[model samples]
Every structure is written in structure tokens, then in C-alpha cells.
Target: MVNAPAEQKKLPSWWSGGSVVYQIYPASFKDDDGDGYGDLRGIINKLGHIKSLGVDAIWICPHYKSPRVDEGYDISDTDIHEPFGTREDCQELIDAVHAHGMKIMFDLVVNHCSDQHAWFKESRSSKTNPKRDWFYWKPPRMIDGVRHPPNNWRSCFGGSVWEWDEHTQEYYLHYFCSEQPDLNWENPETRQAIYNDAIRYWLDRGVDGFRIDTVNMYSKYLDFPDAKVVAPETPWQPAGDFFSNGPRLQEFLREMRKEAFSKYDCFTIGELPNTPSLEKILSYISTDAEALDCTILFDLADLDHRGGQYPLMGRNWALSQFKALTAFAQQLAEPEHKAHALTYLENHDQARSVTRYASDAPEHRLTSSKLLATYLLTLSGSVIIYEGQEIGMINAPKDWDIDTEYLDVNTINTWREIKHDAKVQNDPSLLERGRAGIQLTARDHARTPMQWDGSKNAGFSSNPDAKPWYRVMESYAEGLNVGAQEDDPNSTLNFYRQLVSLRKAHKDLFILGRFQLLDPGNDQTMLFTKTALDGSQVAFVALNFSAEKQPFELPIELTARQSQLLISTLGKSSESRELDAYEARVYLA
Candidate 1:
């Protein structure tokens, strides 16, 4: 490991702390080549729209050379995918983003590589191969004259994590799909190669930073043990305790920071899964140590999750739960803690926030959308907005037939699992519940092509007859398209723009201020304040999560201060403190 001094490490700048990032799923963003796929050229063609949204940076999903068994997550090589673009196209896109005065963050998937990768091929060639130790490979357990997997660990996709390789007569471990084999971080050569060859190569190309995928899974327990059965109904329990935040994870991350990140002026945001405790997350991103700049924890997003058998399960989240989660998240931004939290409502892996957390009714959608935006933008930590979220995009119709309609690989796999279980149990209601669960929880709801206009393919592709990789939403042409709402003064899209503008204007209060939860016991309404360190400026954000109008009273302490309305969903200032249905307001003092 490269031992760099802590003093030499580059710290995050003011812009990094305050910036809003926009996430782009390259496959579903735009199809500039009209080949039914989004490419680098397509992203370059749409930079103007991103600029108009006022985000400081854009985090592009994986575009590495891959067989696409799990979309772009299974990376086969360290080069650009031909379908997405060539290396030249990638360079041009990066330059264009810099020219537009915006930074670009690439998705970095280092926990594993595609089984088709050259390194994996060499490692699996023979037990005596020089690279044989680069991956986790072991002989299968011979029980009762039968060959079985080494352990009870199950893959995230399904089935056993250990896949038997007939060629070598050994079982190779894969936490995700069989096509994607987990890398052995314990091997110094392997970790060094990933850092020097892959990571440094990208940084040298003028890329800003990376959104590290499954970063907390880099280290694993030395002993391959059977995971405890947390959910008895399922065949295997999640092996998060053994793999998610391993004992050596922090050491490995610090080494990565010292070897690569400390030398450059870039930020690192790690995706931490299965971390229910804030203390565990803080250890990975605390600024006091040589670790990541920020981390995304799923505690808030998993509030409504049910059915431990499957990873993705959902129900209508309660207003009280939402308030509690938000309040707990805000507490992480206290002045004493060095780490920063990454706040977000939706992403490529999640369903649309409007349909999941807000009302889907036609009259209430806009107001609820605006209310969510107000709460998100006024938070103390940096925020990320998923594509299409600014325009109040909802999930696909509940009646969509998964077998016939376009669905992402994640959704299709989960649907099959749920269907098989339901059939085995001989219960038809289970199947019905599974279908409804997919409608509310499937990740494909966010993977649909961007609704740009009412033209062919939702204006995402130039060809009039080209079918997109995923089916476009039916409501795109009806009214949900960007062209339909871009110019409307009261549209959800405009409300997002206004919120972003307001956040940027009050960076000191929203970005660098101290967060305090006010009236924390209230379930239907959430009120918070961000005050400057010196108490010279203050900003208060009030959100009504209920469908019915609610009465609110400003705190007596704030009543003496002059209040200036910054932005409000109701479009009018009320002296009586009566908030309209799903209304949100920001007041500056």
C-alpha cells in the first residue's frame, strides 16, 4: 500500500460541499445514434438541458466494456463499451462537460469484474495459474457422495454464491451474478493493480471523481462461513455481516485513498448497503480519517421495506416514518462530525420518488412534487437528483404485464422469484401482491427512457420507428414529457428549477449552516431550520406531507424576526400559517 501523509491529502472544496449532482443512467438517457441505445454522443447532445437544471455535476452510470449480463455492472474490460461509445467519444464528452462549466463523475465498479474479463479467465484457467489467487476459489464440499457449494452464502441475484467450474473442478464465489466474480481485495497484487491500472488511468483522463458502486463490500471475512438465518422463510439469509462491511474495509479504503485519491482534487462517494446503523456509516466517510468524502446509506429508503425473502419490497411509507428518517439524517450534519451525508430521494436503482413517496393523483402530484423538492434542496448535506425526477415522473402503470412489457434485468429476475414462490404456495393472492409490489418497488420504473417530447420514442431517439431498449411510459406523450412542462410557470419542472436556484443563492445557509430539527414530534408536518454559525442568517423549511391542508404556527422565537418568503408551492404568503394540501415553503430571516 502507498503510504501517503494525511497532510498531503486534498480536502473537499466549498463547491464540492454545496454542489448538487444529477445522476444519468446512460442506457436510458438518450439514443443519439438511433440504435435503440443511449451513447456518449447522446449525452453530449443533451448537456444544455442539464445545464438548465442548474446541477453542478453529473454522475454517469457505468459505460465500461461489458457483456451486459447485469446491464453495465458486469465490466469485461477497462475500456469504453462499443455500444455506448469509443474511447475518443468518451474523451470528447469529458472535454465538452468541462467546457460547459460542469464536472462529470464516472461510476466506478471495483468490487467485481465480469467473469469474461481477462484476469478472471487467467485465474480460472488452472489451479496452478499465477493469477489463481486473484479470486475466491475453493473445492466444493463432498457430502454423502454429492458435490455441494462450499458454504450457504447466496448470491444477491439468487441461488448459491459459489458456482462450480467444471474446467478446474473448483467453486468460484460470486456475490452478484455468476457472470460477475468478486475480486479478492486481500491479495495485494490484485488491489494494487485495480488502483494503479484502472483507477489512476481514469483520473489521468481529466475525469472529476467517481461514485463508487458497492464500495463497502470490498473486504470480506477471512473464513468463509455460513451466514446466520435471519429470515427463516427464505432458503438463505443475506450475508451482509460477513461481506458488506468487513473487518478490513476501513484499512482497504484508507489504502485506496492514500494510493490514488489523496493525490488529486476529487471527491469520493461510496454506496454503503445493509448498513442500518449510522455509526457504521460514519466510520467509512468521517472526514477525520483518510476515507471517502461522503457515503449513501439506505436506512431512510428502507423504512417501508417488508418481506425479508426478497431484497426489493415496498409499501406506502408513513408520514411519521418519513419525518423520523429525515430528522435522523439531519442530525448527521452536526458541526462536530467531519463526515457529510449524501441526501437523495431517487436514483437509477430506485423507483420514481413522486410515485413512491408522494401522491399519484393528477391534482396532487404537482404539489407533492414541489413539497419534496423543497425539503430535499434545503437540507444541510449535498443532494443528488435522478433524471426525470424534476418533471414529476411516476412509476409505470400497475397493470403492466412484466412478461410482455419492457423490464430491466433486476425487475425480471425478482418477478420470476416471486412468481415461483407464489405458485408453489398455491395462493393466488400472493401473486397479486407480488405484482403490486413490483409496481411500487421495481427499479425499472426509473430506467424508462427520458420523456423529452411527444414525438416518436418520446423524443429520446431520432428514428421514428426505433424501439427503445426499455418501453417509454404511456403518459409521456399525453402530458408528462419535458416539452409539455418546460415553459409552464407553475409546472413541477419549474418548481425544481426554482428550488435549485434558491439553494444556490443561499449556499451559506443551506450548505454550510447548522441543521436543527424543530417540532420533531409532529407527524403530518416537518419543520427544520438552518442557521449560520454566527446566527446572522437563518432559513426555515416547512413541509406538509398530508393530502389535507394543515394549520401550522411559526415558533414564537421566529415570530419576532422578519420573514421573507423564498419559495412556496401554494404561490402565496399566508399570515395565518395555514398550509395548503401538500404545501412546502421556505422562509429566510
Candidate 2:
């Protein structure tokens, strides 16, 4: 670990209490060098724009040295990638972010490393190599003189998790893609190297903290056992039960906290997928545990998922269901738990919230977007806003054919699988249905370049002749561009600004207050009240989720006393009990 004095920068005690994070997909954010890809310098250029959103921190997606497989998640090295810029550029970005009074969080993907990593290369060189234990390698199982994989585990991308090396005559486990091999965290040497070389390397450079990628999947069962087959026909099956939140996850986290994180005043949040239970989740972030500051659980994101499969298409969720889920989430983060909550509506892995939760119809789109913003900002937790979310960006145009136009690896793989299944079933119509599914849920929808202006390539790059690395959304010139909304008082971008300002102004009422759900029986409306623990402050937020106006009656006791309208999407006096379609109102009661 680098013992830099600058790494010990002091942080406020209230840093985690009421902070807002804005997530940036670096490659799609901007192109400063005109190389058709976003680089570190591009992020430096947009600091002012991000600062205008009133976010406390920015969570930059992985820009580490990689083969661009899985969009930089497959890291060949922990250093800055050449395409993004040199290590100096990264340090400048960090310093620039701090200058704006905002912190920066880097994406830390340590569950695995690219097969091309030096350690992985050395491990694969020979069976007797000293670094052979750095990765999981097992002898192949032989059945009737036929060689087969040691177990039935499957890779997340597709196919078997084990790949046999002809030269080494052994199989190495890779839960993700064959190009990415799972690191042997069980080895003390591997654990120490990751902490000393990678984690401290960034912290020493003035990074605030990390959003730990797949934090719960660090450990595995000692025995390489077979996974239960959930789908017999498919080449890949769900093996998360055997690997996700594995046996030694908490132990390893505590070790990390004591060894690396404890050295500096920093923030740490984990991208924990497939977490088993609410009790288990609380343990990870609970103050008593001291493992992590917070975690992003996928329970809310999977609300409408089909059979809990993230890639498969799912149905629209009801307003009542949304209310129930949020209420449960609030309960989990109750003050008694003394745990930090990382709440968000959109991120790099999911489609835009405007398209997922709100009606995309032109007439209702703006109102729905505002309604979701109110819910996001008013919720009692630290909030995260994805890039382009403030400007009301929608999913990629419905006409952009997934087979030809989309470049997201996840979308491409899922589309191919869907089409293959359709062909095997001899149903041509399924191909069209599969296309629609991909259009609705593909991660590409969120990967489109940021809409900076109405210019060609959406002003993401200055070179007029340069094409973006990914397809820019077709709706940019029509009004979704940032330049068009900057001056408009009623624009979605302005609405987000106002909402964030409101949250910052009333940190005690919105951030430190206890959240209580109201009118749980209302299926077309969601209502909640945030009240300070001492009962000195209280606010009620009402949302009309349906397409038609709804009548709402305030509690008799509340209406008996005078109440002040704080904010509303309808931009009208909040005296009436009737709410317009997609209306959201916050009242100081």
C-alpha cells in the first residue's frame, strides 16, 4: 500500500447521510480526443454539467485496461486503459472532481480478471507454475474414456463455466466469460496482492472509494460440486446459489475493511446481485458488521423480471406493487438498523427508468418522468442518478433493430439465444417476439451516448465527420438533447435540479427522517410521509401513477391544520384533493 499523506483526507461525518451519486458510463459519456470513444479528458470537460445536477459524488464505470470484452468489466490490468488515457489523466479527473466539491467512486471488479492478465497468463503457463493456485483449476472428469467438465456449473454469459486447456490438460473455472477467469480469493497471497496492489493503488491516488463489483461472489465452496440443473434444455443454467454470496463472503469483506478501507476515510458500496435474504443483506451493511457502507440490491430492479431472470422480458409492474416494495425497502433501512441505504431507480445494467416505469406516450412522458423524479429524490436514502436520466432520455428508438443496430454484448448474446430457441421450436413468429423483448430490456438502451446537443453525434464528439462508437438515440434532435432543455424552466432537466435542491435543503426531513407508507390500499396512487424522529418536521409526497385523474383525501387531522405546498409536477397550488394524471406533490405538513 502506498503510504501517501494525501490519502488521509478528512471527510465529514454527514457524508453518507444525505449524499447523491450520479453514475457515468465513461465510454458513452463524451469523446474528447475524437477517437469515437469517451476518454478521461471527456469527463473532465463535463464536470460543470455534472456539478449542475447537485450530486455529491460520481460513480464512473470501469475504464481500466481491458480488451473491451463485457464493456471493460473484463480487466487485463487495474491501471487506466490506453484508450481512456494514461494514469495521469485518471489522477487529474479525481482532482477535478474534488475541486467541484464532489467525490469520485471507481468501479472495482475483483471477482475475476481477464485471462490475458499477467497473473492469469502465468497460471495458465504450466500445471506446476507457482501461480497455478492463483486461479481455480481442476482435473477433468472422465466417463467411459470420454473427458467431460468436472461439474455442471455454467458461465453467466453462456455455456459451461469450465474451459479445458489442451496444453495444460486441466480446466479453469470462469463464472462470467471464458476470457475472464475467477480469481482464487481463498489464497492468502492472491487476497493480499489484490488489496495492496489494486485497492490501495487507487486510494493512494485520491479516489474517494469503490463500487465493489460482484462483491458477494468472492468466495466459493471448497469442493467443486455440481450445480442443480434449473433448465435442462438450455446450455446455461442458474448456478448463483452455489457461488453468489458464497460461504466466506462476509469474512473476506471484514478482512478487506480492516486491511485496506480502514486506512482512509472513504466510502464503499457493493453491487451485490442475487443476495439471499433481507437479513443477509442487512448484515453486509450493518454498522455492527463494519464490512461495507452500503450495497445495491437487485430486489427492486427485478420487480417485473420474468421468473427472476434479468435478461428475459418481464411484465409491467403495478403501482401498488411498487409501493409495497419501497415500503419493505424502507423498513429494512430503518434507523434502528444503523445501516446506510443506496437507493436508485436506474444504473448501467438496467434500461432507463423513464421507459421502464413511465408511459413513453408523448402526452404523458414528461409528467411521468417528473413523477418518478419526485419519488427518487424524496425517498429516505442516498440517491443515484444515471447519465442522461436528468434530461428525460428514453430507451433506444423502437425501430432500431436489435440484431443489426445494438452493440451491447449482453443484448447481442441474449438476442442470439432467443433466435436460436425460436428456430429449434420451428416458430418464425417467435423471432419477432424475441426482437421486441430485446428492444424493451436491452442494456444498450442505457448505453447510448449522452445527448449534449442537437448536433450530429449529439455533440458527444467535436469532429463533425466522426461517428460514435455506439448508435446515438434517434430522438436527440427532436428535443431530448441537453442544449434544448437547459433554458426551459419546465424541462425535465430543470425539474431534476429543483428536486435535488429540495432534498439538499431539507436533509433532516427527507434523508434522516423515518419513512412511513400511507394509503397502501390505493392501487392507482402511491403516498408516503417522511417525519423527523422528534416529530418537529413532516412531509407528505403523493403520486398519481395512473393515466386518469384521481381523487385523494388528506387525513382529517392533517387537513385540519394548515399545510404548505413545497413542490409539485403540475406546477399549481396544492389546495385541491384531486390529482391530475401522473401528478406528484410534496407538502410540508
Q: Rate the local accuracy (lDDT) of all candidates.
A: 0.83, 0.83
- How accurate locally is residue 570 in candidate 2, as Cα lDDT from 0 to 100? 80
Model 2: lowest-lDDT 10 consecutive positions: 1-10
State the lDDT of candidate 2 residue by residue for 354-447, as single tens digits.
7777776778878988999999999877888999999888888787877789887767766777778778988887677667667777778889
Candidate 1 clashing pairs, residues 3+ apart or interchain: none
- Clash list (residue pairs), candidate 2: none
lDDT of 1 by residue, 35-95 (tens): 8898899999999989898888999999999999888899999899998989999999988
Query: Clash number for model 1?
Result: 0
